[model samples]
Target: MAISKKISVLLNLADLLAKNKPEILRKNELDMNSFADMDESMKDRLKVDENKVDGMIRSLREVAEQDDPEGKILYDFTREDGLHIVNRTVPFGTILIIYESRPDVTIEAAATAFKAGNRILLKGGKESFNTNTYLTELWQRALSENGFDTHFVEYLNLSRDETQKLIKENTHNVDIIIPRGGDNLINFVTENSSVPVIVSGRGNNFMYVDDDCDTEMAIRLILNGKKRISVCNALDKVLINKNLPELKEKVSDFVSELHSKGIDVWGDKKAASIYSEIKETNDKMVLFEEFMAPKIYFSLVENMNDAIEMINRYSGGHSAVIVTNDAEKADTFMQKVDCAAVYHNASTRFTDGGQFGVGGEIAISTQKLHFRGPLGAQELVTNKWFVYGKGHVRE
Candidate 1:
């Protein structure tokens, strides 16, 4: 299909989705009801309400309005030898995205890929089967109505064994595989898939509070980061400067705010001394853990160097925040921290595609290869080289 036609189809799909909100909600409820044994965080990701439906519609429209990613000339030049060369963006041909829960990904991810002129294959978890199936039907309908092949967007509802077979055999010629889920799923796809994989969705994000930081603002940022425990960008660990004036008061205030929000605080020995209610944790492995619950790990750091080292060692390279008033220290932290998104005095919760103004994302890639942070429509395309040369013989 032509690029403009694809955008028109997406716009139509967005309107169709908005008008059929009741049907989508009904299908979502079936998926929600079937996952009774799932954890609260996973369940939160699975649920799709009116707000989520609206978000999906908005994302489709936003992506449709954006410039087409494919065939955009990135670089054009003529060599000294009179050879003209041009580099342009192109689709990856076939993209397979395997994710768990989050029904909105069905719309956003597919829209991004289709808008970029790529065929998308969605493999959603069984828990969201009903919703994913319904959404895929809508996509097919949109394509059919727009005089496009329904195969442009395909949904795979395969069992565990079947998934393994597909990944191992590469029967569909998937050019790239993106896994948007926890570590287990990402690791499974990376290890089993024959295609190139992009790992995403793990976020053991950390926040460091420097001695010169605004304590009140730090508390607010922490609260914001912890407000949504189900999201990957939610804060998981905190490191506070031990030399901060009134360190005890700061810790007390932070712990109190978290307590008010019904979140559990786990702290190291130094932090535990300030807040008696804080549970003590001695295991070093917990630092590497991504807590997708209302639980955060706290510790004490001597200085900025210590905080940077700790984050680089333990963070999932997702997002990190440093709450400091000193520009030099904040700049140093931002430069040294090995994360996809680094923040100074801001909440890590802003690490989202919509927040970044990319409509929506297929995933927040933790890997540093093809792309990092939000994988938006513009980031979905690969580059191609077009060279022009006359028939000339080389010496």
Candidate 2:
């Protein structure tokens, strides 16, 4: 399809969603009412209000306004034998995205793929069946209005056994698989998918406070990082420098702040020693766990190196941050932290595709294979080589 046709489809989808807000909310409410016993984070992801629908519309329009990612020339070469070669961006054909809840993904994520000229096969969790189905119907409507096939955006309401069989077998032609959920889902797709899988790993993001950092800024950033408990970028751990000024007093102040916000503060032995209010945990395995809740783990490090080592060892390879005033130290930390995004004096929550000005993202990719960081429309395409010759043969 032409770029204009693709943009028209996205714009039509946005308009349709805007006009169908009441129906969309009704579908989401039904899903929410049936799954009342779910956790706070799960409920948050499953719920869809006017604001969430507005966000979906905004993202779709943003994607439509941006330049198409496909057909961009990457390289061009010519040989003396009258042969020409060119490499250009091309769609990945079909992308199967399996996600849990977050009905917005049915709109926002699929917009990026559709804008990049790829067919999207959505496989949302059972909890979001109604909302996902309704949203996908809007997508199909937009596609049909543009004189395109409705199969371009399809929703698969499959059972557990059926999904597993499809994942293990290449029954449906899928180019890439993106699993955006917890470890169990990611592991299942990565282990069973016959096609390439883009693992949108856990959060478990970390932040380190340098001895030379601004105490107030560090505290503010840490607080903001935990503001959203349902996102993959939420802060889960903190590694404080042991030599920070007034370390004990500062720890107490931070702990008090966290408590005021109803956020649970867990601490290691040294961190607990600094303040008795910190719930102490001696288990080493907690460092690797992604607590998608109102909980954060705290530990003390000897210096920048120790902090860097601890973050690299325990983080989910998603995002890491260093709160420091020292430019050189911040640079070193940003360069050394092995994550898709590293921050200096900023909250890990800012590591998002929309925040980074990419409009919408298919997933916040943590793996290093096809691409890293936010997989936006531009990153969704693969390069193809085009060769031209007239009765040319190689000797």
Candidate 3:
């Protein structure tokens, strides 16, 4: 397919979605009405409103406006045998995305893949079947209007067993698999898929407040990190340097602010001793858990080394942050932390495709194989080698 056609499809789809906002809302309502027995956070993800629709539209338009990623030459050379060689970007052929909730994935992710000249196979959770199918219809309509095959984007509404079989067997001949959800969904894909899987969406992210850090900035960052509990970038843990000046006073101020916001604060022994409002815990497992709720964890570390070690061991490899005024300390933390996006004197909440200026992302790839960080349209492609020889024979 021509690149122009791909861009047209995305822009047209955005217009279609914009004109049919009511329909999208109605479909979302249908899904929400039938859905039952889910946590508030899950419900928030499943539900789509005017703003999310606007966001989807903006993402489509942004993607359409970007340069085509396909066929960009990486290298060019002439061999000694007079053979011409070139390497250019190429799509992954087909991608299978298995995700939970968040029907916007049907729009944003598919637009990116299709823009890069890849067929998309989306398998959203059953809870979002209505919205997913409706959005996919828009994609098909856009493709058809542009004289392209509707199969460029496809939706798979399969049973749990069927999804499992497809992942394990590669029934659709997909080149890459991206799973967007909590650990369970990501784990299932990584452990069972026949093809390479990009692990994403888990965020037991941590922040370290150094002794020399700006106290007010640290507190502000912690609050902002918890601003949205349903996102993968939400803060889960905070490790304060034990040498922080007036540690008790600063921690108390932090706890008081969090309480005013209705967020639950959990702490380890040292942390709880500093703030009476913190609910202390000894369960080591909480450190490994991604609390997609109005909750956060606090622990005190003896030094920068201890803080870095703790973050490396317990974080979800999604993102980590260090709040410090010392440039050297910040640099060391950013380098030593093993997360995909490390922040120095910044909030972990910025670990997003849009924030990182990728238009939008298929996923924030935590694994480092093909690509890392935001997997945008450009990142979604592999490379191909092209050679031209004029009847050259090997000597």
Candidate 4:
């Protein structure tokens, strides 16, 4: 399909969603009511309301406004034998995105893949079947109205066994698969998929407080990172330098702030000695845990090197932050830490596609391959090499 037609369809779909807000919300309500056994975190991700609808509309508009990602020449050259060669971006043919709750993906992922000229097949969890079905219907209507094929975007409501069979069998000739959810889902897709898979949506992020850090600013950063616990980029572990001046007082104030916010804090012996209320645990496994709730794990580090080592060893390679006034130390941390997004004296909460000014995202990729960090529309495409030759044969 033409890029203009694609953009028009997206804009029209945004308008349709905005106009049919009530109907959409009613369908979402039915889904929400039916899933009474879900945990609070899952519900938070599953529920769809006016604000989320607004976000979906905004994402569609932004994606439509961006330039077409396909057919852009990345490299052009000629050989001595008069053969022309060029490398340009192209769609992946078909992309399969398997995700759990978070109906927003139904719009963002589909819009991104479609705008890039790829067929998208969304396999969402059962908890969001109603909402996803309704959204897919709207997409079909938009495509048909714009004189485009409805096959551009499709939704698959499959059970666990069916999903596994689809992945293992590759019945649809999927070019790539993106799995966005907890570790279990990610592992299942990674182990079972016959196609190339992009691993995303796992966040065991960390933050370190340096010896010369601004204690007050550190507190603010910590609070911001913990504000939303259901997201992948939320902070899970914190490492504090034990040699900092007034360490006990700072730990006490930090603990108090976390407690006031009803966050459960677990600390090492050094931090536990300062804050008696903090539950003490010496388990190293906590360092690798991704707490998608109001919980945090704390430990004391000897110095900058120790902090960096710990962060690199335990982080999910999603995001890591270092709060320090020393520019040299911050630079070192930002460079040495192996993660998709690294921050210096800033909150890890800014690790988002929209926040990074890339429109919306399909997922926050944690693996290093074609792309890492947020998978924006532009990142959804791969390149193809084109060669032109007339009567030229290999010698």
Candidate 5:
């Protein structure tokens, strides 16, 4: 913690990072193109392409250079006995972040930790080892340049066995563990890790087309929501009103187009004639839940009440969008949907850090405790009370 030790650490990390920059950039360049061309499975595992990764680092640098998330005074109160209570924000100190194939997550999580004054141990998806290593090196370089402890951003370059060992053995040193991946991966980390967890749950976002929705705008919004279906915020479900004007003509045409583009469609018997492209099975429930990204389901509902019930039954508690020109209708749907974020007149895909005007987000938090939506550095800090009082004897 000494000034000299800090300087030494920063300098050494800077030198190591400087030595590795060119090689890292070269590797990233190759990854950029190859990753962009990869199929849905490979792309989903990586999450983002290289150009986006570069943009992410830039965004982090800008975010870090801004005012700190900590150092803010939240509240102050005084008592009649000359006692004062002041609430101030502070960092969690040490955090462990476990995530799947989104390589950019390593840098983003590290930046949030750095801004909050916490040390981070990152365990990224093995599928993106090469990408993770270089990104971690980039973040270390940034930390060194800022004269912060480079070791504050650590990584465990190990397989499943070693990862489980660290989680089991170093629980005491870790103040919190954040899991940022699929349901199974997150469940595994949360169930097994001895440290407290900030779980970022998986998203199966929904999009509802209300009777008041503009048909042209609805098509555009739905396409935008599902264009990048691999993302956590991508629209996974589409709900259409059973009795919209030209309901069959407008929605049916749009749904058919989606099917042509490889999206699957499922729905009630009323919608069955429109979505024949979706391969159905004898088991209705099985077909309804089984979504492959281009696939969407349409169900005819009598009113907003039915739509609300359907959403509650199917939503994965991440993001939901309601397309309605009517203000009251939008409000009703938003109120009924249970998720981290709800949208009106916009694509569910807009549920993102940058979209919300934050420079970047650690991840979309589905948990209610520390954070609930797109999380920036401000979401990374906890609060403490500072009390002051004059001597007063008890009666």
Candidate 6:
């Protein structure tokens, strides 16, 4: 099919989604009870149709217009033989994404794969089967309408066992497999799959508010990061300096104030002094991390060195926030923190696809290679060199 026709089909899918997003959100909200039974294994919900699928296509189309991320020559140099050598961008052939209960994955993955000019196959979580099915159907329809093989962007329809088969036995067909979800889900895919896997590192995200931080700003950021605390990027641990005279009082007041509003808070010895209900434990829950919803824990530090030490001890390199007016402190934390996404004063929630302005993204990759932070359009692509040289033969 012509590139223009393919582009048209994608654009139409976007328009349909923009017009119908309100309805989709409304429908999901109205049926919230049915969608609320949470499972870590689930990829995303299954309720997508033409309208839902369209939005994803639109975001990809928007990013594609920016510039061809691939195909641009990165370097050119002369060899000892006076021959020209060049390096450029190219696709990674076919990419495979294995994930759970987030319908947004469908659009983000599809759009990005399309933009990169690489074929893709999605193995969605079983929980979101119905939703992903419809979403895939719309994509197939779009492809058929544009006279292209839907296989270029296929959605696999196999069980967990079948998914395993594809990951292991079908390694020849799939170039790379990306597993997105929680720790266990990602772990399972990484361990069992024979194909090369890019570990989308487990989220042990953190938020730290130094003694120099603005109290009002600190409270707002904490609330935003921890309120819906079940998310991957939600603030899991909060660290505060013990040197400030009002350190205990200030943090306690802010934490208690939120606890009064149906938020659950658990804190360490220093944090417990402020809020009585905060859970106190000997072993750092930070070590064997639990992704709890509506829970906030605290750790007290003696100084900057202490704070940095604790941050290093617990942080799994997912996300961290430093709430301080001190430029040096923020800079130090940014340099030391091992996480994929590091924050200065903003909430950990800002570690999202939409906020990062990549149109949209899949999971924020905790891994370093292939992807890190938000997995958007560029993450979905791999580059190869395109050389145009005259009489470039070896001696």
TM-score per candidate, chains pooled: 0.97, 0.99, 0.98, 0.97, 0.85, 0.86
Model 5, position 271: C-alpha lDDT score: 66
Runs of candidate 4 with Cα error greater than 4 angstroms are: none
Instruction: Please give the range of 10 consecutive residues that has the lowest summed lDDT in model 1.
Output: 386-395
lDDT of 5 by residue, 102-199 (tens): 76677666666666667888888766777778767766765666666668887878778777777777743888888887767777777788877887
**True-structure lDDT of candidate 4:** 0.90
Question: Cα deviation of 100 in candidate 5 (Å)?
Answer: 1.2
Output the number of the lDDT-best candidate: 2
Q: What value does the lDDT take at residue 143 in candidate 2? A: 93
In candidate 3, which residue pairs clash? none
Model 1 has a clash total of 0
Looking at model 2, residue 389 earns an lDDT score of: 99
Candidate 4 structure, TM-score to reference: 0.97
Note the Cα lDDT for every prediction shown: 0.91, 0.93, 0.90, 0.90, 0.70, 0.69
Clashing residue pairs in candidate 4 (N, C-alpha, C atoms within 3 angstroms): none
Report clashes for each candidate as comma-separated counts.
0, 0, 0, 0, 4, 16
Residue ranges of candidate 5 with Cα displaced over 4 Å: 1-22, 28-39, 44-50, 281-292, 389-395
lDDT of 6 by residue, 269-354 (tens): 66677657677765666544845566667777776677667767776677888889999989998888877887888988888776
The lDDT, on a scale of 0 to 1, for candidate 1 is 0.91
The parts of candidate 1 lying over 4 Å away from their true place are 79-82, 390-393
Winning model by TM-score: 2
Off by over 4 Å in 2: none
Winner on TM-score between 3 and 4 is 3
